[model samples]
Target chain A: MNFKMSVVVRTVADIMIIPIIVFGIYLILHGHLTPGGGFQGGAVIASATALLIVAWGTLKDNKDDFSTMESTGLTMFFLLALLGIIMGFSLFYNSLAGTGGIFGGTVSGINPGYINTGGTVPLMNIVVGLEVVAALSLILYMMAKRSDALEVEE
Target chain B: MLYYILQVLVLIGLVSTAVAVIWFKDLISAAIALGASSLILALQFYLLRAPDVAIAEAAVGAALTTAILIFAIKSTDRTEGYK
Candidate 1:
C-alpha cells in the first residue's frame, strides 16, 4: 500500500522541512530571551512532522521511540526542578542563575539578548520542547497510519 | 497608522475566514478555511506583540490541525450537507 503525495508536494516538503526544524530549534534555544518558548517551538517542529507525514502519506512509525523520548523529556524536566530543592533552593528555583554555569548569567539592562543568560529557563524550555515535539509527532503519525488503514480496509 | 491599518485588515480577514469555515459544505474545504482562519489569527497575535502565541497558533492550529482534519476527512465523507 503505497501512500504518497505527488512529486511537487513531496519536493516542496523536502525543501522546507529542514528550515522549519531549524526555526523551531531557534525558538526553543532562545526562548528565555525571545518571545517563543518550549511549547511554541515544539509545536513548530511538530508542524514540520505533520508536513512530512501529509506529503509522504505513510511512514514506518517507531511509536516506542517517540513515547520513550516523551517520557525521558518529562522526567528530565522534573528532575531539574527537583534538583533545585536538593541544591538548597525551592522547587523550580533558578539554581544556575548568576553562578557562571551554563545558561547562567544576569542581564543588567535592556540590550541585545544573550543565549546563555537565562539559567534554568533555557533548560526547562529545551525539555518541554522535546516532550511536546515527541508527543505531537507521535499523535500525527498514529492518526495518519490509522487513516491509511481505514482506506485500505474500505 | 500602519499598524492600526494592518490590524484592521487582519481582523477583517479573520472574520471572513471564520465565516468561510462555517459556510463551506465540503469537509476538506472547511478544514482548509479553518487553517486560513488560524493563520490570520496568528498574524493578529504577532501584531499584538505576542510572537510566541503566533508561532504556536501557526504551527498547531494552521498546520497540524489542518493535516489532522484532512486525514480525518479521508477516512470519512468529504462533503457534509448530504442526508
Candidate 2:
C-alpha cells in the first residue's frame, strides 16, 4: 500500500523522531543500574530506525542507504570492541578508563558503583545500539519495499 | 507457596508452547507460537531477576524476530513446509 502523508503529518512525524532517539540513549546510559541495558536499549533505538524508514518515504526506495549504514554500524562495533581488547583488557571489557575515582562515585576503570564508570561498557552500548538500529531498519525497509514491489508485479 | 506455583505454571507454559511450535503444522502459526513462548520465557526471566535478558528477549525474540518471520511468510507460499 502506498503511504502518502500531508505536509503537516510529515512535519509532526519528523518532530516526533528526536524524542524517540533521545529516549533510547537515555535507556542505554542508565542501563547498568536499571532494568534496561545495551541489548534492550539497542533494540529500542532500532525501533526508531524502523519508524524513520516508514515515515520518511525516501528510505523505501533507497537500498544503498540501508546497506551502507548496516555495514558501517557493524564495522564500528567490531572496531570498538577490538580497541577495548587492545587497551590492556579483555574483549568487551568494562574497565579501561583508568583507576581514577569520580568524586563520591566509584573509580572510573576499576571498582564500580557509578553508572558512567565503565570504560568500554558505555561505548559498547553506543556501538551495539548503532548496529542494531542500522541492521533492523535495513531489514524492515527491505521487507516492506520488497512486498510493495511484489504486489505491483502481481 | 504461591510463588512456586506461579513459577511452575510459567515453566509448563514455556515448555508446552515450545513443543507446539515444533510440532505445529503451519509454519506461520508455529512462528507465532514461538514468539509467545519467547514472551513466556521473558516473563520467567523477569521473575528470576534478570531484567536485562528479559527485556532483550521480549523485544528481539518476541517482537522483531516475529515481525521478520511474518514478512517471510507473506513473501513465500503458505503451503510450503521447511524446504
Candidate 3:
C-alpha cells in the first residue's frame, strides 16, 4: 500500500530535502577546513533520508541500490588506503599533501582556507561520507518498510 | 556573564528533558522528549566549540532517532511497558 503524509508535510519535505543534501555535501567537501567531516556530514544526509521517509512513507524499492552504494564506498576507501601503502607511505597516510598537485596546496598562514589544500583528507571524507549516508539510509528504509508491512498485516 | 547564564539555562533544560523522557508513560512523549534532549545537547556541544559533534548530534539524535522511534512506536503499543 502506498502511504504518504499530508500535503503540507510533503511540500515541506520537497522544499527542504535539496538544501539538506546540499549542506551535507558542503560539509563533506570542506571537511578538512571545517569542523564537520565524513561521519557528521553523512549523518546529515541520512537525516534527509529520514525526512523523505516520513513525508513519502516507505519506498517501494531501491534498497539494493543503497546497499550497493555503501559497498562501493567502503571498497573505494580501502583501495585508497592500499594505494597509500603502495606509494611508500603508511596505510591511510596523507601522501599528496603540499605536492602542488590536485588537493596538494598548502595553507601556511591563518587564512580563509583553500578547497584543494587538504590532500587525502578531502577524498577520505567524501568516501566515508558516502558510506555513512548509504548505511544509515538503508537502516532507516528497512525500519520503515518493516513497520509498514506489519501495519498492513494487522 | 551572559554566556555562562545561557549555558546554565540550557543545561537545566537538558536535564529536565532527560527526566521528562524517563517520566512519560506515553512512548511517543518519551521519544519526543529524547529528541528535545538531543537538540539541547547539540547546543551544548556547539557552546563547547565542537561543531562537528553538534551537527551529528542534531541530525542523527534529534532527527533520525526520533523518526525511527516514532515509526517503531507505531508498530506496537504506545504505553510504557505492558498494558
Candidate 4:
C-alpha cells in the first residue's frame, strides 16, 4: 500500500466510520422507543469495524484470540438472554420496567412513555453488541489469515 | 406518509442491489453489492418498526455473510468467464 494513498484512504474511511458508530450507539441507547435497538445498532457498529479492517488491514495475527473473543461474546449474549427467562420472563422478553419515572421516557417501567427503564433490554443490547463486534472481527481476521496463507503458498 | 415512501424506496433499492450482485462478474464486487442490499433491507426493517430484526439482518446478512463469501471465493479456484 502506498503510504500517501493508504494514509488518505485510511483517514477518510476512519472519519466516515466514526459517525456511523456514534449513530449506532445512539440507536442502541434509545432503542426502547425508537426504530433502532441492540441488534441494529450492533450491526451498524460492526460495519464500522469492518470498514476499519478494510482500511487498516488486520490489527493482529493471533487467530486464537479472535476465536476466544467470539466464543466469550456469544456466551455472554446467551446468558443475558437466559437471565430474562430465569426471571420468569419469556426469552428475550423486556421485563425490567416498573410504572413511573421521567416524563415521556422510553423505559419499560410503570411509566408508559419512558425510554430509559427497560431492565434486561439494555443489558441484552450490550451483550448482543459485544457478540456482534467479536464475531465480525474474528471472521475478518480468519479471512485475512486464510488469504495470507494462500499468498505465501503461491 | 413520507415513511412509507422511504420504505418503498428502500425495498426497491434492496431488490435492485440484489440483482446487481447476481449480475456482477467479480466475486468480491458481488459480495459488496450483496452487503449493500442487506443494508437497504435493514433500512426497510427500521421503516417497518422492527429495529432488532433489522440490526441482526444487517450484521449477519450484510457484514458476516459478505466476509464469509469473500473468504470462500478467495480460497476456491477462480472460474474463468461468467455463464
Clashes within 3 Å, all models in order: 0, 0, 0, 17
Model 3: per-residue Cα lDDT over A1-154, one tens digit each: 1388999999999899899999999999989998889999999999988888888986658889999999999999998788779899889887888888889999987999999898888888999999999999998898888875774443
| Tens digit per residue, CA lDDT, model 4, A26-112 | 877777666667667767777776677666765556567757766776788788677668889777764555523432224334554
Least accurate 10 contiguous residues by lDDT in model 4 chain A: A99-108
TM-score of each: 0.92, 0.71, 0.93, 0.69
Stretches > 4 Å off in candidate 1: A151-154
In candidate 2 chain B, where is summed lDDT lowest over 10 consecutive residues? Answer: B74-83
lDDT of each residue in B35-81, candidate 3, tens digit only: 99999999999998899899999989999899889888987778998
Best by DockQ: 3
Q: Could you tell me which 10 consecutive residues in candidate 2 chain A have the lowest summed lDDT?
A: A102-111
DockQ of each: 0.69, 0.39, 0.72, 0.47
| Predicted structure 2: lDDT | 0.71
Model 3's alpha-carbon lDDT is 0.90
Q: Which regions in candidate 4 have their CA more than 4 angstroms from the true location?
A: A1-5, A62-69, A81-95, A99-115, A151-154, B1-16, B39-64, B71-83
- Ten-residue region with minimum lDDT total, candidate 3 chain A: A145-154
Winner by TM-score: 3
**Fnat values, candidates in order:** 0.79, 0.47, 0.79, 0.60
For candidate 1, the docking band is: medium
Q: Give the TM-score of candidate 1.
A: 0.92
